[model samples]
Target: MTSLNEIPARTESVELEPLREDKKKIFEDILRYFETNQRGYIKVPTGWGKTFLSKHIMKKYYDEGKLMLFLVSKNNPLLSQAYYNRKKNQPLFPNSALLYSERRVDRKELAATLRALGQKKGEGFVLFASLQTILGKQSAEIKDLILKFTDLAIVDEIHNFINNRGNDFLNEFGERTKILGMTATPFQGVVGNVKFVDEIAGDMREIYTKTLPECILDNELAPLKYTIAESSEDIFEIFDFEKGLGELDRQDLFLDCSTPDRLKKVIRRTQLAKDVYDSMVKQRHAKTLVFCAPVRKRVYGVGGGDKEINAFHAKLTSSIFNGDISAKKLEKDIEPVLPVDFKNYTPEGKFRDAVFISSELPKDEQNAILAAFREMGKPPYVLCTVGMLIEGFDFPGLETLILLRPTLSMRLFEQQVGRVTRLSPISGKQQGSIFEISDSIDSLYQRFGEGVFSGEKVDQVQMLQPEIRLEELFSEGDAARAIEEGKIEIKKVELGLRGKGKGVKIKEVPVKLPPTSIRAKYFSRLLALTEEKDVGAFEREKRELMRAALKFRVRELRDAEELAKLAANVNKLKREAYEDRRLGDVSRQHKPKVFGEVEWLLKLQALNSLKYEGEHLSLQEKNRILKTLGFEPDFRKIDSHRLKCLKLGSAHKTIPELVKVLGFVSRLSSSETYQFLDKKKKEQWKRELLPAVYWGFCFIEDSPELKDLFESTEWDRRVKNIIRQK
Candidate 1:
């Protein structure tokens, strides 16, 4: 087993050339495009220095005595870098002034700079501001002042501007002031009904284009390599809504649908922690970036008096460290900038090679942390973050990217993977390595298509799946049966049975248990049995194994019975309350009606009808139904109908038509045709029916009444016929 404590010593690094020669040729081509077009944006891969190229254009306009306005989005690192560069008196853009909310320059001085630029006296001065600041209602005066003085505006990462605010900012400028927008992926996603690429194409022309594969071929970026680490444990075994319904009801699982997403997140974090630690052990000298799952804080507003805890972040960080240390000392060492409500819990670790950063820290403090991480000989070589380091941050020597966060957004995945593609030949870094720690890669490829790599082959690394231990398998309720059935593999064992004075029998047996300390304990017990001499003692020893096997079966049966009884109680409650009303109305001279635990479905149907009719049920009707469903009536800001369905374990089937189909299943479970099938076949039929109905209901909704058609003997055939016709 690979352990966290077995990290190897750091290897020495080698030095190489500062910059690749091909950048000069690429730069010359881009310069020619800009000179001919006068005003247009160029598409360059990340780490190809779009900032450097944009600055080149800015300097040209500066030399010609034209003032420029440079805009970036919020949370962008370029804003901080520009601020730092100006403070350090760097040559990049020394004559720049900031107009963001955190500006340190006096308004009088800003006004003076704008006045000088407007009068053509401040020849080289430029203005930098975030889009939020320029579009703010409070900054209307300054916004007007800058627009009047600026001759041209440069927008970085313009794909981020596919929003109402971005459109509003662009609308303020005209052809008198040239608008140049730069981005790597303008066609990232759709804004409302239009693609972002199409929406921006009308306003900006593509001056030059460079794809990721082209960049690699031209030696502009390092070649890419990636790996997908698969977790041995399956998440489905931990959760089964139907089989665990009774246990789930006791815990009120359906009341909050977020439970499933939360469980997946925690499990994903744990798996990533192991693989990330293993990767660090393999590459002790590499500069690595780890993207962790978002920090999830659970706020206890009632009993704890409004307290918050960073549950997953703390767990993941401690798992990565995996060291022996006092919880208090560990907590104090890796303290977060913001206060947490960890009344009884603190993470334990003493690992100092990694540093965690988030937006909770002040901007200046975040900058200082990044500066320390950039030091080659520093103690902290790995930087862990949730989302603070994905965009616009340039670290050419970063050689590895460990992705612990799974994303469905193509734009987000691209930005994250781009972090390590920068060339760092000076630090002996040749190829970039990406470690994808989850199963989200397939969906991402399907969504974005294979052209994401631009024909660049991404080599796969085969990671060994973690081992399975006997204790772990035995402790798991579902997998315990595999051990008793001799399905698991254990090392061979030999035992000697003594029959007479000098005669002895030896037998070799293949034990069916996973390799673990528990296997050794079992083998020791078996050896004790083989040494028994007396008949009674030998029988007693043999019965011990049988007793242990029976214990597991008994526990499994008991759990099933408990779950069955709990489900019965829930159904009885729903049926009883509804039947009482039905019987009461019958005694009062009304016709009796057939009923079951179907009021929730009826309520859903009534709501759907009312919504379709452009109306709502009376308050009395709503409260009456809600009260019978065991929820308080007229609760503030709560969706009563949806909550009722969730509590009843039918949250996903919310549409009236689907609810009606489930109610039909409840009715059919008691019908003659359904009762005629054998137990095993009946279970298989039900499992097939539900998912089939869920996926095919739209095609067969108008074919016939579900109850009437499904109640027949040939109901399965009718279902297929109806679906095939559509």
Candidate 2:
């Protein structure tokens, strides 16, 4: 709870430059509009000093004895960007304080600061708040504090709040306060289920806008050299169902990084970016900035692609650039051994681990890396980021931007492209280079609009045709080679399971089956049998053989020759299962006729064993098992010994008397029970024991056991109907 009172005042001084004539006019026009309007938004390009203009205007209101609130979303570097700007431009608001989640205000200190500022005329206090922090779980008190003290609110990156959560916070400040929202892209086109432009218009009026073209024309920003390379469909189709993915909702698939199939696409796209960077621009360095596709986890996982055939995975490539030599061991063996104190010791011209930054990183660590990246001839000469560096962040030395992910949001695309557009005289940067890796350049041109990056030169946007197509680099044999070389970790993916072809590449399987489909499940099991170690398959086969032998015994089949024949047939089926050969041929030829209505009881036992281990049984399996076991499978409470004794003509005695005479055989240990009964009776009971105790016992109407069985059956039926949508 570091409050304003605990924080030190800014003592350093900064020389200020007079705003350019065009920028000065735009700034004054925004002030003039705010004088008449209560609420409005300003749209301007990224490098146009939007933060300075807004803060300058807020200071005017602050001088008029008004309390101002500067707001941005949580995890937004803008909050910190504004904080640093405040330190540089101390004359803007002398009594300003930060109110983000990381550095919260003490309630008492905040009240005192506001109270003192409130007492004096022409004195104001600005609370720079993070919307994500103020509107979270413990937001009631903080929201009340903001509403009580704030007179005017200036929201930055306003496009982020075009949702119910944002509206609810906005609605809290009714007519008592005036609002002004600012963003480079005022309307974000269409996002998810709604039209974002209409939503923004309903909330605030768009008073001003400055496009990239206008900014470039005014010489306010650097000219950009754009290049596009379409990723090969053949490389993508190397993974199953990727070709058919065109028919599916691509936007939804893109967001879902949970599945290995989708993640493989992202990895291949990233690998293409790496190749393009290596061939086109790695030597020049020139402070490259890379934007990668979103991943669920930033660290270790199975990433599919081949370099023995052609591509470097996302994690491995990042580790190489980041100078994190240790991470490479997950994919392959480490090459040269490094000094123990490597991270802190940057020997001579050796690069360091500042090459990668993402939203998943801690704020302080991200800030330190960003600071390093901003400097010219730095360790992170080539920097990679997920999405954190796209908006608000300023880096004049960014001369190269590589986009590895495609976006449907025009605003986001513009923001990503704008990162490298800032002019840097010290670095002698006249133009920025943008290398885009995607499947279609025509679709990009159509989606982002034509001539979006038009410059004074005729060849502003260049299309670089790859000499060796991505598809040409891949072969069906490369996947197995990469796995053998330990470059690709083989994941136990539950896809493409049913095919019987041994050593079949996953890319060749083109059928698209839902993850939960019965066919997909069978395929996964089949894949495990063929691709994985034989231990699991052997255990499963042994269990099946033992269960079959028990079934023959239960059926009163005493022929040793028939038993031997059944064991041999089971062994053949097991061998075929491991060999990826069809089981039907062998089964039909030597299969036993032991499968009957009573055999369903043995199936129940097998299915129940799976349940006992907490494995998920499919709908068909669940129904079959439930139908055989009488639903509720608990048997510990059933008086099996008492029932057996009563059936053997001991019904005249009470339950207690029977327990005293028969000694509760189920509760007694095996050796103790055998001592109580003769050898013949003991063997007979042992053979028929468990099933007789569990289901062979009789139950009358209104009994608790009977009620539980009925309830469990009804519940199973209800669940099955719901799951099947019956």
Candidate 3:
């Protein structure tokens, strides 16, 4: 059984047992996300015990025996971790399984095993399986188990397999069960990546994110000593549109970097970077993991055609690059840079051609090799991969990291650097180290290392763009143009900005370009706009003005640029409201008579001639009706009909927000006087009019009607059909 201490970073919050303040905060955030039924990701630095926090929160939330945990993964690594924690937190999950690749278990066996432990309602039970096993091998059975029993599915690393694995689950499960996605970073790549994340888990609010610098400063992660080798100018020269690739190639860049010179430059810079780190860290660069440019075989297709290309991308991201270079040549480059003793290279611990894995080694030899490469005092002091080791993999001896992967993706770059940033659990190492081969990938080290500060006093966080794919490098982000083309919008932000201090003041901050589906653009634009003075619209209609003012008052609580754009979104919303009202108005005019929620529909029903709905009442004459109803009863003073019509129209003009406002007054038709109708007819009019009057005049909770329409249901479908027609 893994002890509670090992499972979660916690303490008894008292004098005898001190609490881990950071972990406590993180755990509380997780609890809030769950309590709110939120469905998004939270980020914690690599060494901030993210796994432990997950365990801690899971224990807290699973106090209800009704909870059935579903662990979603590609492999059993998380499953094993969960198993250990479950053991440590026994009775919390008395029934749990750890099914890995080598020892596979079918869903039947899994289901039976869980049921055996607890068949009663509220009995705690869980099943753990890799997404591959559940979605691929035991897909049908797992689906049955999920549909029949599972309540909440806790997915690990959604950013990884969400497009496919997540799609499979969502398609089968629908929205019948709830989902929780856990990851170190919330956002992934720019276009396709965010789309997938949004598809599976993006709808969920971003509960919390603990920045890397915070973790490092707090000693949860080691402080990184980052160094850049090649100047940005030299690095930029490789992708030089003027030198390496012509403007034509730049116009349409391929997945594989087309320019041979550029690829060679990447390789050379990578080698140089390795040599620098090896000299600095005292190794053959074996312990240093290098994140390289993603090596894909071909173009990435959205609908799944190029298999090998996809596999290469996945494999590169997984960090098992196996290739070698000339040892003699490698030594020649580094020998001049450092003294002879700068690196430790022996026959037994020599820098191998292929660093991460070599199938040539026997099982025991391979195990020992892995141990040495990962451990502090072992041979083969460096290792390398692409985006693979950014998260999940834990190794304390990985003291230094060399950045060979020239990337523009800020999130990817941060994640890669985060590899070595963790405070090694075993070594108690105080600092992590990073060597940049080239900082040309948009000044990777400078911006990340020294975060941009706005004011000396104001403490506010401005959002930054996380993903900058290589594709974006080829073209200018013309988001403003897109906005003009109606591809983007300056949405009115509903910031419940509360509390006050002369928050962040934006002075001379260059306004960021409009968001091109990139957070940087939105964040930048917002920061500038938030500092603006002009806030409200004076030209709006009464209802519009009232709502917009309410929205503005709420916004003033915080200092943000989004408030500046509030009127634009408000205007758009006002247009929509007007259109809905117009639809109802038009439907009334075209109708033959009046009566219901639509004033026009009600008017059609109400304006009937001799229209009492019954055998005896239907036969009543209009003169008799007028006399009995006491409506212009004398008939000679009957310019009274015009007077009654005027009165009804004026009454319906109030409460524009209430959709059926006119329906109540439309019932008071001059043509259909009520006095002559039989008792049954009067009763019928009262029966229907009472509800119609209630809908238009009364302020009921279901006034808007849209709130009651939960999409795809019959009522919602009907409302949408009416909206479309209108």
Q: Candidate 3 on 428-492: residue-level lDDT in tens?
A: 55566665543343322122222212110011111112122211211122332433443222221
Kindly provide the TM-score of model 2 when superposed on the true structure, using C-alpha atoms.
0.51
Model 3 whole-model lDDT (C-alpha atoms): 0.40
TM-score of each: 0.49, 0.51, 0.48
In terms of lDDT, the poorest run of 10 residues in model 3 is: 455-464
In what order do the candidates fall by lDDT, top score first? 2, 1, 3
Tens digits of per-residue lDDT, candidate 1, 210-303, equal 7665566556777665554543333222222233222111211111112434443344434444444453335675777777654323421212
Question: What is each predicted model's overall lDDT from 0 to 1?
Answer: 0.46, 0.47, 0.40
TM-score, predicted candidate 3 vs. hidden true structure: 0.48
Best of the candidates, TM-score: 2
Candidate 3 lDDT at 534 equals 23
Highest lDDT model number? 2
Task: Name model 1 segments beyond 4 Å from true.
Answer: 1-39, 83-88, 187-194, 233-269, 276-281, 295-311, 322-351, 362-365, 440-726
- Model 1 per-residue lDDT at 314: 35
